[model samples]
Target chain A: MTTDDQIIRNIISGEQHAFRVLVNEYEDLVFTMCYRILAHRHLAEEAAQDVFVKVYRKLHLFDQRSSLKTWIYRIAYRTAIDHQRKKRVRTIELEKAPMVADSQDDAQVLMERSDEQQRIRRGLAQLKTIDATLINLYYMEGQSMEEISEITKLSKSNVKVRLHRARHKLAEILSRKQMEAT
Target chain B: MKNWESDIWRYLASELMGTELESFEQALKDDPILADKYESAQRLKRNLKDFPRLSPNEGFANRVMQKLPAGLNRNLWVQKLNRKPAWYFLGGAVLLVVVTLSIGWPQGSAASSDMDWTQIWQWSTQLPLSFVCLISAVFVLLLIDRVVTR
Candidate 1:
């Protein structure tokens, strides 16, 4: 497999296809990050495109000190946050969770899962952009505090404290949502 | 009670270990409020852990590649533009307006009166040579800036 370093070298050497490789690797993660912040799939897709475009332009400045994943993540986070800040006045619309159906049982389970996903998405939409992002980096992506710190530029302790706070806030929102649903 | 939230989150995350873990679990069994908090945190953790993965539509990478060339060209143009001061463009625009007025005012005046071509030529020639040269220089510089940036 071509390593990340190799991919970067190839891209810097004018191998445009290498960028596709990089984008393919991180596209879902970047899209998910954007979706978490923007709370709309269409906006998330646009933001993801912007993130890749930016990464392509700024690839030369990567420096290789941090992992490529973290670097792309930082770019995705910042771009999504910028979109959110600019469009704060716009109402958020949740994208319907996609369903896969191979069997009746599978369809049933997927429907339940989709409902849960929608609930989580709604809860996240209620949060401030930074808080939602912190929760996403911590739980959804399963990033280490140190890695989250690197991606977010927050201190490790700050990441920890803020992540905990965000977790509590998300729990509060989810519980409130559940309370209302019943 | 004040620290119960973090404690419950820590427990849910398995960040609490050994004695801390034991004590929190004990508190969970003893205090109904702490138990309730733990239950909620555990549920949230489970939901977040199982957070549905979102994917972009197919050919996402291909679309990105298609966008790359145009994006690169635009970025290069912007970076080149940024290297020069805005005042250069502003000066060019101001000079262009002045040149248009200088040339247009005489034509306008001539058309309004019985003044013929010679009178207009004389008026033009009577204008300061230095001002004309300055306008030419500004126009040429603006053209050169545009070419170099392009």
Candidate 2:
């Protein structure tokens, strides 16, 4: 296993193989991040690929001031967010046309939960983007609050507050659904 | 429920830790309403924990690798060397030496006596004038050839 520093040096030295090694190591992490953020397979894959290309072109600009993983993840997060923004704009443009004949079916399909498990996923989806991101990073990825704060550029206390609110929102959504079902 | 209900729930979810955890436990113990909120929070956390992960399908790695940019197989040293400005400077230096030696050799052998210090200095002074005249002559000849061909 090549150390992160060694991989960086190899990349700087123009070793194509070294770039491959670096990509192989971080591909899953980057892809997972994009997947979580985008929630669409094709878009997530494209975003992940774009992130690697950006990393390759901008590697020389990397100052080694932070860990390579953190830098890469930061890039991945930004890229995913940018893609999501663009996608939202496109969706808004399409919203003018009564494009949906039966939007109710989609909501019904989403509501069919075998257990409370689906409620959590639904709640997660409904939470604010930053809140959902915090939960994913903190719970799903098992990142420390400090790491989450660093990634999101939020203060530690702010991250705590957000995480607290995010979980509460999710719980409230779940409970509401349960009550409606009864 | 109190606003702290979420914090209490997060603590039960194992998402909040350390001082936050102790504080939340104390809050839950003190307020019955807070404890009831904590129970719902625990259920939600448990459901989330049990939620199935949507892993990327098989061949996902292959798909990603296939989409990667090309030109990754090129030789590193060659690529680096091609990008270095020093190589162009070195080439220019070699060309200068070759041209100087080629021009100087015939002149040196033809006028061995004129190659002496005083004569060499005189020749060096006239060299720029000779170069200008030679360039003009080449241009004139090319012009004449074009006119004749027309």
Candidate 3:
């Protein structure tokens, strides 16, 4: 398989076909990162598309100082954050509406595992955006601290400390849920 | 010893393994509190790892592809070169060459005499203004191109 760097070089050199390979390789990771941050599939999809478009436009500015995946994920992270900010502004203009109450029967139909998973998702949502992102990048995405530092532009030490704190916070959230269940 | 609870927990998470592992394990064997914290840390690590992965929808790629601009298929060099500034430069250069040739090429009998000393002096004096105008026009065109493209 062609490396991502090779594909990017080819794309920059005018082979449009090479971009398709990059899109295929990174779409899932980008989509997942956006989804984790935005928590809405449609918004995540839009963010992902925006990220790739920015990537294509700005590829010339890419200096090869970092890996292609790191650069792309950095773009994805920034795009998702920007989308969220815009969404927040728009949401503020609308009148607050009461959240729809799920029917008891519908709630009961969800499996315990599914419910637990939802609780974890909710706990993740409770985290500050950076903390949540650090957890997602470190755990779900299986990125190293150095890679996370590059993507987030944090120092390696900061990445380590923040990740440790975020994990503890997540564990506390999960433990509280476990207690509530019992 | 300084409190290595955090370090022990970090090691268990595999974030602090390798070189630090043996020293931490040695510390753990001697300190009961450290061992207890290590156990809790291990549980937390397992719990975090066990969270279900979220997979993208099957049409996710198709949806993203649909949102991209159609012209993105063009080659990168072609795309970059096709920007307004490049075209402006090319057009300006062509116009400069056309204007220079037009002015220098005199009709019939005048063509030879155009190079004569007196005529050459006249042309030399007029050339600076024309050159300046051409340069100014090119500059203005470039500025206009940048604003419009933006």
Candidate 4:
């Protein structure tokens, strides 16, 4: 129930439980972003955990120039990209990328598990890491372009240009698949 | 399909406005292909938006929390340095003055060759005890910086 500033202040004051609250608060956002970018559960988990550790290490340097969410997302995006590069996987490979975890309610999950795993993940895999991350930030996370630019270190114009390219690429890939099926 | 590159994107992202928005809207109604592409693009965005989110398994928070505390206590001096840099800055300035003053023996004089250990000892004896303490403090500061930065 504590405000983010109060949580940050408590953490800077060396309260261990305050950090726990922070980790809990942002774990899902960090983990989901990592998983989508890397398309590997284990790597995403490691990256997410590393992000929190880094946040703790660098907490004292948080100068309050940006909101806590923006700062943390920057760290998360940077860490995920670092791990993704070190793994040398580049972008997520649809062939190897795991299907979204199994769920009875998820028809897409069911479809992905069965015959057409490549339908969407393939298009996403073709995207550059920055481009895929742009889609995730915009559509999935609902971040504004300004925030996306801050997180990705791209200029606003660059974000707009790249996001448009990414969307077009996805449409082309999906439409090509449909044409092939017909 | 091809023409939807920039305008359709801006329209669906709700970024297009004023004249540009009206023109795109008119085009959407006038052109079947453009309208179809817009619908498909919207579907693409909706699907991406609804992409499944992955949550950390139970106790993920505890695992990360457990790893943080050990490193937190490792750099005690850095914590102090971050908290109060002014004191350290002032201390460093005083140390510089003391070291400079203490080492300020008249040098390269006409009698430089004749200066001996006895003369050096005499020069040292003339310096205040506080100068010697300041040199020791400088050494301690260097050691702390090494440890903290390591």
TM-scores vs. true structure, each candidate: 0.62, 0.56, 0.61, 0.70
lDDT (C-alpha, whole model) for all candidates: 0.71, 0.64, 0.67, 0.72
Clashing pairs in 4: none
Better model by DockQ, 1 or 2? 1
Better of 1 and 3 by TM-score: 1
Per-residue lDDT over A1-182 for candidate 2, one digit per residue giving the tens place of the 0 to 100 score: 43987887787676667877877788877877776677665687778888887777566556677678878878888898899898862322211323232342233223324346455555666776688788877776667777787788899999988987887677666667777988
Interface root-mean-square deviation (Å) of every model: 5.7, 12.3, 5.8, 4.4
Tens-digit lDDT track of model 3 for A47-117: 88898887877776677788888899899999999999998622221112123323421231233135445
In model 1, the Cα lDDT at residue B116 comes to: 79
Pairs that clash in candidate 3? A14-B75, A14-B76
| CAPRI tier for the interface of model 1 | incorrect
Count of clashes, each model:
0, 0, 2, 0
lDDT of 4 at A42: 73
lDDT of 4 at A181: 88
lDDT of 1 by residue, A47-136 (tens): 999999888877766667788999999999899888878777232344233444333223323443566666776677677677778877
DockQ of 3: 0.16
> Which candidate number has the best lDDT?
4
What is the C-alpha DockQ of each candidate?
0.21, 0.09, 0.16, 0.28
Instruction: Kindly report which residue stretches of model 4 are placed more than 4 angstroms away from their true locations once superposed.
Output: A95-118, B1-27, B30-34, B71-79, B83-150
lDDT string for model 2 (B83-103, tens) is 234445445555655565456
DockQ of 2: 0.09
Native-vs-model 2 lDDT? 0.64
Which one wins by DockQ: 2 or 4?
4
